[model samples]
Target: MRYLPVLASVAALLATSGVAVASPAKIPVRVVLVTTFELGKDSGDIPGEFQNWVEKLPLSEELPAPGSYHEVLRYNPDLHVIGIVTGEGPAHMASAMTGLVLDPRFDLRKAYFILAGIGGIDPEFGSVGSAVWAPRVINGGLAHLIDPREIPSGWSDGFVPVQGDRPDLEPVPPLHSQWGDMGYTLNPGLVNWAYELTRSVELPDASSLQANRVRYKGFPKAQTPPAVMVGDTLSSETFWVGARMNRWAERWVKYWTENTGTFATTAEEDIAFMQALSAQAKAGRVDINRVLILRTASNYDMPPPTETAASLLKEEANETGFSGFVPSLDSAWRVGSVVVKELALHWEKYENETPENK
Candidate 1:
């Protein structure tokens, strides 16, 4: 409420209780669902059949395009709950999210942002389609605006000094010659909490599966709860080098970053956004004291060009571009549902206890 501006548009906004009867009262947590499409397609290029299935999900609102944040919220007035697309790379992700965060309407103090989408995983630990979590999200794309050559190669080198009063922004000296990694949620308790929530989700038919196969192998009873191997997520402004070999090389940087206290995964927006948020927290301009970023891997960085040569072949064994990877999409959709339901449950609990609101 403190951040709400007296703008004409906001004045016209009818203030609902900000509490939905379908949810628990005074939810201590605000969950945000963020997705991205590096390939610039709609609905994550989910297999057409799988798209149909995801659409049936009882989401509060659905958007027409991947990067169109405004459209997703058109039917849902609960601005606190929203979605964003990182637009081809990190700059777009930064620009769009900066707009949202700076907007007087967004209650940054109470909201937690979750960055969710597909990502490439380490072969031994994560196969395609298997979900990976980034407890330590690294902004691999960030560097001094002036010194382009001063690219931090690992987490220790990239520990940028955010401006303000908060101790969290202390100018951490670059211990290693790389970028710094930011921890979104270090609470091990919450990690286990999230794992238990989705581990039991039944795996769909394996005949059409692609990624996350080994984790859910033998058709085991959802033993992992849709787990994500948490690490540093790398960010790039440019489209991933489209050659498979090149992409593979770039991933080593991701691996090194993650191994050295940063989880390197790729997305366009999070690096700058995190820097801004850390600055704001230090300045007392906003209180993102409990922010959490949860993202699903949509693709691995540096995808092979042979797998997707531009305009070479329109249709393949699979038309939707997901190939046989429908189940991963299903897994993402299922996880989103659980998040929404849990938000509702929190709302319900809060309202039931409020004397006047009840």
Candidate 2:
């Protein structure tokens, strides 16, 4: 009976230590909605990027996320959809994405990732409250920058390509090797399909949005109502503003994409998000091609003719100061939910084949 007691004690220890218990079967996630931040709680408060998904989608279950920026994840059991808030900025986004792909509690191999957020829109390409789908995400921080006062007489601005000595260097050096992470080209077919599917999506148009857009006197596109369009994004931690910075953003995207990408949205996290997902893809944890980026225009990247960049930025420091703040959030959910619903409802088809391939 001494052996029996010892065996019982061992069993107890093993059970307490989780060594004798098998982990629960991993949950199969069909769709992941990634938002950058939340204004308050997940619901019943002023909404940020995450509120609509949590409330409208009705993510009722909470899942523990150990290493993510936001330690809690919201889930909708019926839809097989998961919502994550990555806080904000590049560091938070990278860490949250890495944590998500590495979490063993979920099977994400066939999951579709939708990164939906708001960004500063390029007035030349879009107006506030516009929803943009981007196939190209360029890292705007990977560059050599000098103060404008110290820049060479002929240079446009101080920013230069990481692989070149000057702005718009001829025959841009091949960045596919060491600097490959600096630019990410998403599945073009998928982007185009998403654009076509949601191109006619009518975004919320309010008097505030209209009044704000009219300030861009020379930018015809900015004066028009919001629309769904396909544009490229530039990601950087620096919240740059002004005409010069806008020009640099446009040229930078073109330079990185070999004159193929038009910069429309300026944001802070997509590059890091893509990098993390790319790593997960290599490990076969996620399908990188199933990723989609949607950015709504909460504000303009630069000031209008009536205001200076400094003044505009100061005004925008308050979250509600952006004229399209509420409208942009509405646009994000409106445009993004269409795809989310389709994918969730038709998981059998999307699980085997991405929309682009279909």
Candidate 3:
């Protein structure tokens, strides 16, 4: 489990200088860790404790060396860990991920990925700041624009067709529901560990946990707690502007009602990021069974932040009055803290119990 520091550092330096280093020594798990700017790009606002924990680890592995994929490398020869910050969005994620996967320098026998960041939650979940772990990833942006006049109101139209289209656009496959079978298993041990670790950090309790547990009555274990909420997530290709975000939110709400589904809105890029990893498994690139996506919501899209007036007194008065009306969206941070802790604890348990490692 130990790597030669001198050798590793020398290798890193050569790699950085456009010189290929000797092939990397095989490690335990080849991990591809990804995060987005949603949690603040600097990583300062991330729970102080979380930052400290990761900083203490020897994750300093060289990222993309010249022709390689990523930038920062927190490599630990003992743990066989290399944490890479794949850039933001699908284009960046896909390009960077593919680079790492295809790079012949590293051996990826036991591939594992953790796509962690913040996400926006549905209002039904009480506040916008809650964290969400998506069990299913759906492409909400693929739906077609259906005029009510063209389709009957009361019918459940599985597929809707588009009207006259311009030559510039390729016919969008009828906006139908496409599901990606990301094989990440719901590790009960990990879930429990996350919950306990989060609790240790003093985060708030899950408001919708119990309710969802009841809704999904067929849940295998009675002791296992339920997830936060049930909402469809919508993804967008462009940086979400205030105006467009508002319109899309309205559209998503209407679509949900019409389809009898409650979807929480997100962007389109995550789909590509996730799809790439899923493709690797399908293609036998690695032995990755599944991946867990932890996201934190950064801003409120619909019902944009009110326009600021020049009058200070008027603004103060308005802010005071609206204080009671606003739902704190910052709770997602707390939830994220807890989830991260749980994973750490679960890993500890597995490490202690595994016979080979022992």
Candidate 4:
């Protein structure tokens, strides 16, 4: 989708003006593309790719939000796509979402949301640039927090289950859920349909990414080039790393999903993001089942076998360590674009009707 040059320039103008354009932030739009924080305020970094991509699309409206983290938008009046940047992390996600969803300018009840972001991936399950469709989004932040050293000798990790008194129990609903619903399980049909649509799309790869993937010695899947897959996501405000935390992530997803969902990516905001969506659903603003999350692995959650977590910390902070950042953004947008495009092209079929998983 080619973007209008004016739309690209409008972002700069909005940043300088620190004001909302007179355009409507409220409208019955087709799609609400939700992206998390971009590194630079004015725009730079892989996280900003989604907005950059939107800039290239034909824009009909520029609804700027100087008071908010970012802006609401309009692309292809015909396609009716609007993008929302949920700031970053869980708190930012809730705040930004509340502002956007509750804003009176746009109607969200019929909008299809795609929460796309980069995540720390498990090399055991996927590689950098691999796009994952989350069937279940589990919260890793709101849990029993214990210092690993003080926990029972046999305890798996520092994070204990919120539902049970012990660390190793599956989550039982109506127990400790802050969100009335224990976990946000996306519509199976929507998730499967999304997976099927982009699973075959060829994602870009880089030599640095290849070298990084090669580090996953024993895991063949992580060694492959970027691809799309269906997997679950783990959301924690704590950006954790190490074999221990990685194991906790896997076990947490397993316990929450009852082995039905496999954890592939680790992110910081999906749980809170979805919870807000649930609220909007209750208010008859949006369909909870229409929400979809796509996470691309920007880097592995744990250090490779050859490197110790402590040893790799400094390196992981370097640009070379996150070689997948750019490619992952590419993969996410490329794969996610398919769904966004297909729906926009066939809005008559998808606007009011939820498509089957087929």
Candidate 5:
């Protein structure tokens, strides 16, 4: 009873300190910009997939993201937009996305997820610095492989369906529960709307990009200027190169999507990201239909006519090695920000209804 005065004084001090007595309500996020990596700090340095977003969108607030790849998330308070770096590769992507969706700090049920990053483009589809909007994300990491020397004579390559004994087996084995699905199809209406909105926006075309583009002698699209287009993406942990592997990718995507998906970009994380988001959507934590994947071209998946796969692979061994590196980053932000800004600026309308419905 004598300590009543002390307890009252402590409560008064705590109140004066501006600390809440109860848990604060979770933040309501309108848009989530997902990038794969960032070089150095978030600003005033070499930009990766995340730097332009952090600096240009000016995500001024920092939120602690435990169990995520980068661990710190950037936020634009006024726009209710959040930016995160998931690191590179499939493992990091799976961990980061799963942690983000399950985090209690943000209300993500109605949030729109924009996965914007750079990828190796298929010269048949587009050239360096081209921006691609993917309606289908195919998983390229789940297949069984055999050495080229051991492969059967008639087979195209060594890759085979995980459950089947041969390549391009009809009725590709049903998606396994343990391995998850082989392909994820995003909302077509929303994807088309986004494409229509930014299709005319010009992409950066540097002299270096042009020089590299001209190397692909027989591919007409490879020589053309970069443009915005709708294409499918393939995600794999292995960074494969060469013409044989490119053919494999094209066939794999066609097989998984029943010849509906055309392979345009080769990336390392989208499938894992989609897998996590799918699970979250099932749990009612996120709306998977609102997810958008935007991949920009930093380099070609296979070598040009005069170059060998080994030589091109060696040239692209580092981040700065790709000719379209900077332009791809610019293209990603230029194209993706249009949609992100639209959703955020008109949150009142977009929150309850996605753009597809409009």
Candidate 6:
């Protein structure tokens, strides 16, 4: 007697029995977690923040947004949540966000967006590992660059807003008025509400962060452990590190928000990511008011006066300066998780109505 091959027989039996494999269900994500990049298995490989969230959360679906830099999204159906990484930098973030929002697989209409990432914090505002809620985001990249020596002696930075032919003698109005340049804001109620929710969360700490804070010896805020606060953020393509650069950031945020926005964190992608979100909101695909930008202080934009910017940037021992990424990431997770938990746990109340920011 001749025996049929086991694989073929099994396939035929299964087919005859009408047993078919079922595809995973599509995710209707209610909360979207955004991250810029994550630790690579190798020192420089780069995994993604989505991995950590997926590991912690009960994400079952791995949905693919074909053209996005963070092509895959890990999702949890029961909680209605999804997490994605937009790679790193402005262009990649803009692309990933735009693509994800427009994709047909998921409906993001009622979803709340959370931009959680590491950034350069102004020491005057907070210490490393501090988590901040940005009420406004100003652009620092749309500027004309000049050599510091060539710029007027009174100006702190060589960078000037594009509308002007020269650096301003004093920080003034129309911070970003030249055509495409502009600043962005989050809903005041939403921002304040988020701050109230996360302010009490005990953030992570580190000995290195303590040593780093000592550099800010005189500045009380910078010398303490990380805390959650509300402040504004500035986005720029340049990874600036110096006294002059810090001054530029502080002034730029002040000018753009008409003295309302306080510059707290410095990063490259928040503005780019938000621009896309705002556009989608105009098309009615997203709820702009529900969006939140949360930045954790991974490092300071400049070193203490005792150390020169050049030395901090070039010193072999310093590598990337006094702060570590883990502390900030931990702080961000600890605080951000609370807000997410509130939304998921009380979806009925928050689903159709906006939370009172006050």
Highest lDDT scorer: 5
Q: Rate the local accuracy (lDDT) of all candidates.
A: 0.43, 0.88, 0.43, 0.77, 0.90, 0.77
Give the backbone clash total of model 6. Answer: 2
TM-score of each: 0.56, 0.93, 0.57, 0.87, 0.93, 0.85
Q: Candidate 4 on 237-280: residue-level lDDT in tens?
A: 88778888888888878877776768899988998889888887
- Candidate 2 to native Cα RMSD, angstroms: 5.5
Minimum summed lDDT over a 10-residue window in model 2 is located at 1-10
Q: Candidate 2 on 136-185: residue-level lDDT in tens? A: 99999888888999999888889887677888687776773223767898
Q: What is the per-residue lDDT of model 3 for residues 1-358, given as tens digits with 9 covering 90 to 100? A: 2345565677889999998666876444534445543233223454321232245443544433464333444455555555555555667777766776666656654544555554444333323333455443544444445443565555343223233232112332233323432112233343343444443333232443333223323323311332343344555554333433444444443443343434454544566666676666677775434355554433233322243222322422421122111112233334543443333434654333421232
Give the higher-lDDT candidate: 1 or 4: 4
The TM-score measured for candidate 4 stands at 0.87
Model 6, residue 148: what's the lDDT?
Answer: 77
lDDT of 6 by residue, 153-173 (tens): 767677766666655524443
- Predicted candidate 1 versus true structure: per-residue lDDT over 151-242, tens digit per residue: 34433332232332221233442442334343233334444455456566553444433433433433342223335445555544544433
| lDDT (Cα) of model 4 | 0.77
- Residue-pair clashes per prediction, in order, are 52, 0, 29, 7, 0, 2
Worst 10 residues of 1 by lDDT: 158-167
Pairs with backbone N, CA or C atoms under 3 Å apart (clashes), candidate 5: none
Candidate 5 local lDDT, 68-158, one digit each (tens): 7788998888889999999999889989988888776778999999999999999999999999999999989987899999999999989
Residue pairs with clashing backbones, model 2: none
Q: Give the TM-score of candidate 3.
A: 0.57
